[model samples]
Target: MLLAPENTRFSFALLWTLATFSGFLLSLLFIEIGEKPDIGVLEATVGGFAIALLQGCLLKQPIFCIRWILSSLLGWSIITAIGIGALGWIVPSTEFLPLRILYGAIYGGLGGLGIGLTQWLAISQPMAVVWRWIFVSSASWAIAIPFGSVVGIILRRLTHLFLGEVMGLAITWLVVGILTGINAHKLRS
Candidate 1:
């Protein structure tokens, strides 16, 4: 969790939005232009680190910023890999779109929970408050699944196939992250 100052929720939200947007663009450029998913992953990791560092700077917590960077890198990578792997395992060979979506939601929720748990631990906040935060994060992540699928489908139909999917994924994360940030601000209030 970020150690933000008073009345900085809006600023934090704006920072997160911009960071995610840049991350999305960087990832797309890596994959589409550079033709490398590995590079895309690296770019995403650097973006996460940038977000963490910026948040820390805004919050006036330099030490926590370093922790956040490492945490974000490890947390994001592990959670995404697990979620994707689980999705594959859970809905293997499924032709039914709904079932696939359901599997996606489940895995996304699980990954979100894991990431939130780590954040809660890092912040060392009260159990009650952290539990609510985790729930909000997980729910938002789960909700992104179907929404992302819809966005991906629509974009693919309207544009280049792979580029559309990348855009959908980026937009999905942007929406979910913003919603989660807003909810977190509400909880803080």
Candidate 2:
């Protein structure tokens, strides 16, 4: 099993796929629970960036702009699919979906740096010792995702505690962190 360290277009493409799929899944999660405006791009932004930066900092990979664009669009596709498909569950709000999508891109683009920063803070070192990055990132994600989601929903006075943003990203970290561990073990082997 050769889990190639992300280095080039191919790796970023894979990252885009994973991020998009995860975003779609997260959006589906909302649809299942009767959400209409539920977005997915935010999740992919955070998750893709999370994994991208992880691979970049740990493996010294390079991710370009195209990857981000594709990832964001893919994530938004899920939102569109659910918003259009699930009519019964979706409540048409005054908030413009198109505007939200645009806002998601803008925010995701800017906030995407959180991913790189998280990776840099936690996974910059290349040592054979047991690292504490996973725990640190996990803790931070927990606080950040839930806090943002809860506060945003509350401020808007919404009912659902949906955190399609950084939550999936934390899950991605769990999986990719395992990948990183495997890569380390393989190196040792």
Candidate 3:
């Protein structure tokens, strides 16, 4: 079945969401629940590569795809490393809901900034069209992480599910994908 032009945006959102969630899942293989710098690096590198590769597939330009993946890898790795160093690995606890949410937002926002800036370098578009992506990326991640944290915490507490944080991570990526996908379509145009 063929998709209409307008449907492309939705496709991008869906693909992005899936990609990010899958990336997070893949990261779990190597990541332990800890504050180690190596954990952060591994999480970012593995997750970022998966996310970028899948996202890049949506782009028409081959060179753009390559640049996107490379930039994303570099950006995610550096920012995650810095964030781990500064903030450590944050796990949501029921005791400090508000603080956890705040920390999640800060970490997500910083990560977005790093990824966006690096990706920005790869785009050939005019600054006006492309610049909004940085802010959009930041806002998307900021909102996503907190929302995910709340959901994850609730699920863990209520259901007694192991790895409830995985759900939270998926939700976080879903939000990021939807918001960023819309912006990405605009940037592409």
Most accurate candidate by lDDT:
3
| Tens digits of lDDT, candidate 3, 12-40 | 76766676666555655655544334356
- In candidate 2, clashing pairs total 0
lDDT of 1 by residue, 73-176 (tens): 66555664543432110112333558747865876688667666666644545678778878876787677755665566567668856555555566666776
* Whole-structure CA lDDT of model 3: 0.71
lDDT of the candidates, in the order given: 0.55, 0.36, 0.71
Top TM-score model: 3
TM-score of each: 0.69, 0.26, 0.84
Q: Is candidate 1 or 2 superior in TM-score? A: 1
Please give the distance, in angstroms, between residue 6's alpha carbon in candidate 1 and its true position after superposition.
Answer: 11
Tens digits of per-residue lDDT, candidate 2, 1-189, equal: 665655443455455445433443444443432234553445434434433333333332234233433443443334344333221122223234454444433333333333323343333245433234333333333333333333333434454434433343334334433333433322111
Against the true structure, candidate 1 reaches a TM-score of: 0.69
Pitting candidate 1 against candidate 2, the one with the higher lDDT is 1
Candidate scoring better on lDDT of 2 and 3: 3
Pairs of residues at least 3 apart in sequence or in different chains that clash in candidate 1: none
